[model samples]
Structure formats: structure tokens, C-alpha cells
Target: MSTNAAFRLQDAGFSRAQVEALGEFLDSQAATKTDLIEAKTELKAEIAEVKTELKAGIAAVRTELKAEIAEAKADIIKWMFGTIVAQTALIIAAVKLLH
Candidate 1:
């Protein structure tokens, strides 16, 4: 950036301490800009890593859920067959008793 204000202050014969303070402020601003850029780059990289991990975790959970659903279906079918057999036996016993 232009140091117009600093130059004007110098031309207007400001104290040596005041001019040095302005120089220090300009140096700090430059260092701050560099630090901000580096921080932004690091944050972007970390976000990408987290996104990848989340995708992998979601895929694993989906696979586990599908397996559990299939097991539940098998259990339901087994219970249905057992129920049908029991009902048929009960009906035959009642018919024999009536006879």
C-alpha cells in the first residue's frame, strides 16, 4: 500500500518516535495478511479431510443397516410359519373334540 500518510507526516516534520510507530504498524499489517492466508489454506485442507471421513462412515452405517433389515425379514418369515402350524393343530384338536 501507499505510505502517503507516513510520507506526509514525515514532510510535516513529525517526531522520530511517531514516524517509527507508523512503520511498525505497517509491518504488523503485512505479517497479519500473511498469517490470515496461511490459516485459510489450512482450514480448507482440514475440511476436505473431514468430508472424506464422513462419507466413509455413512457408507459403513448403510451397509450395517441393510444387513440388519434382512435378518429381521428372515425372523418374521420363520415366526409366520410357526404360527400357521400352531393354528392348524388347534383347529384339528377342536374338530376331534366335537366329533
Candidate 2:
């Protein structure tokens, strides 16, 4: 590929030295297989880290929701108990008045 590009550059009236220099510069700029592999490894590591953080956050939110639901259940129970007691008292009072 470099040879083809260099030949093309030479055909375009570039000097031999300029073609060689440009070829070298292009080679320097190109990413190697090793470079790509290293980048892929780093990307995988970063993705794994993000997944761990998200899992931890989800677990925390689940725990908080469970606690909130328990508190609401307790509140409902208290309200139900109070209503039952008041209803019983009124019934007793009405029965006494009738008697």
C-alpha cells in the first residue's frame, strides 16, 4: 500500500525524497495491530468498571425502595388499626344509647 501511494506521489511530480518522507510519515501515523489490541483491552476494562458501578447503584436503589415500602406498610397498618378502634367505640356508644 505504501509502495502504491509512493508511486502515485512520484507520478504526481513529487520528488523521490519527498515521496519517501511522506511514506515514512504516513507509516508513523498509522495504527498497528498491537495498538488496536491495546485500545480494545482498555475499552473493555472501562466498560467493566462502568458495569460494576451501575450494578452497585442499582442495588442501593433497590435497598432504599424496600425500606420505603416497609415504612409505608407500617403507616397503613397504623391507620387501619386506628380506624377499627374508632369504629368499635362508636358502635358501643350507639348500643348503649339504644339500651
Candidate 3:
């Protein structure tokens, strides 16, 4: 049985085959790096889109809460005014009768 040994540039001296193989390896690595960079760029764009959506959601919630708070405050004011008016009228009638 015969076995073919792999050639090393250092052991065999510089040859056209060695240089071509190195070039191919370098090209493959470059292609892989380019793919990774493109993927990272796409991810960043997606993240930006998600952040924009989140901000809009938060703003909508704040606006709704503000409206609810204003309604609650108005109801409280109306209740307070009605109570005061009724109490004052009763007190005036009682004083008038005693006199």
C-alpha cells in the first residue's frame, strides 16, 4: 500500500501549488468574514426597529394614563363641590328656624 503525504511549504520550499492553496484559503476566510459582517448589520437594523416600536408603545401608555388621571381628578372635584353645597344649605335652614 502507498500513502501520499501532504506537502508543507516550509519543508518543500516555496512552490506555485503552495502559493495557490494559501490564496484559496485566504479567499475563503475573507468570504466568511464578509458574511458575518452582513449578518451583524442586519441584526442591528432589527434592533433599531424594535426599539422604535417599544418607544411608541410606552408613549401611548403614558397618554392613556394621563387621560385617566384627569378624569379621576374632575370626578373628585365635582363630588367635593356637591357635598359642600348640600351641607351649607342644611346649616342655613337650621339657623333660620331657630331664629
Candidate 4:
């Protein structure tokens, strides 16, 4: 049937000042932990969003590069065909003039 000061405080016989101070301290500790958790979650979400954007950007660049390469290949084929036809005509004219 005996109790201590800590027990009396638990039973609500303590002074208002002491109880309020203890409550404020507990609340501050809980708030700090909650703030840390929220900050970590927000940072992780931001990082994931940035990674997704970067991947999309890289894919777009790759697609553009592939299109450009295909266009260059077509241009080269046209140039090669034109050069061969012109050279063949020059050779035929020179042979006729010499004969």
C-alpha cells in the first residue's frame, strides 16, 4: 500500500506545473520523431520522381538519335548512286571522243 513520488504523479496528485512540463517534453519528442519520418519519406519520393524523369529523357534522346542515323544512311545511299551514274556517263563520252 506504499507508493513513491513518481507513482503519486502518475495518480494525478502532482502539481500542475510538473505534469504540464512532462507533457510538453513528451509531445516535443514525439513531434521530432514524426518530423524526421515525414522528411525521409518526402526525400525518397522526390528522388524516385527525378529518376523517372531522367529515364524518360534518356529514352527520348535515344529515339531521336536513331531517327537521325536512319536519315543519314538514306542520304549517303542517294549520293553514292548519283556519283556512280555521273562517272559512268563521263567514261562513255570520253571513249566516244577518243574513237
Highest TM-score model number: 2
Displacement of the residue 74 alpha carbon in candidate 1, Å: 0.9
lDDT of 2 by residue, 1-99 (tens): 367888898999999999888888888999999999999999999999999999999999999999999999999999999999999999999999999
lDDT of 4 at 98: 100
5-95, model 3: which lDDT tens digit per residue?
2244535775757666776776666757779899999999999999999999999999999999999999999999999999999999999
True-vs-predicted CA distance for residue 29, candidate 1, Å: 6.3
Clashing pairs in 4: none
CA-lDDT, candidates in order:
0.90, 0.94, 0.81, 0.85
Models sorted by TM-score, best on top: 2, 1, 4, 3
**Superposed Cα RMSD, model 2:** 1.7
> What TM-score would candidate 3 get against the native?
0.60
lDDT (Cα, tens digit) per residue for candidate 1, span 26-67: 777685777989999999999999999999999999999999
Model 4 spans > 4 angstroms off: 1-31
Model 4, C-alpha of 16: deviation from truth (Å): 19
- lDDT tens per residue, model 4, 11-94: 777675776677677666675777999999999999999999999999999999999999999999999999999999999999
- Work out the TM-score per prediction: 0.67, 0.85, 0.60, 0.63
Candidate 1 weakest ten by summed lDDT: 1-10
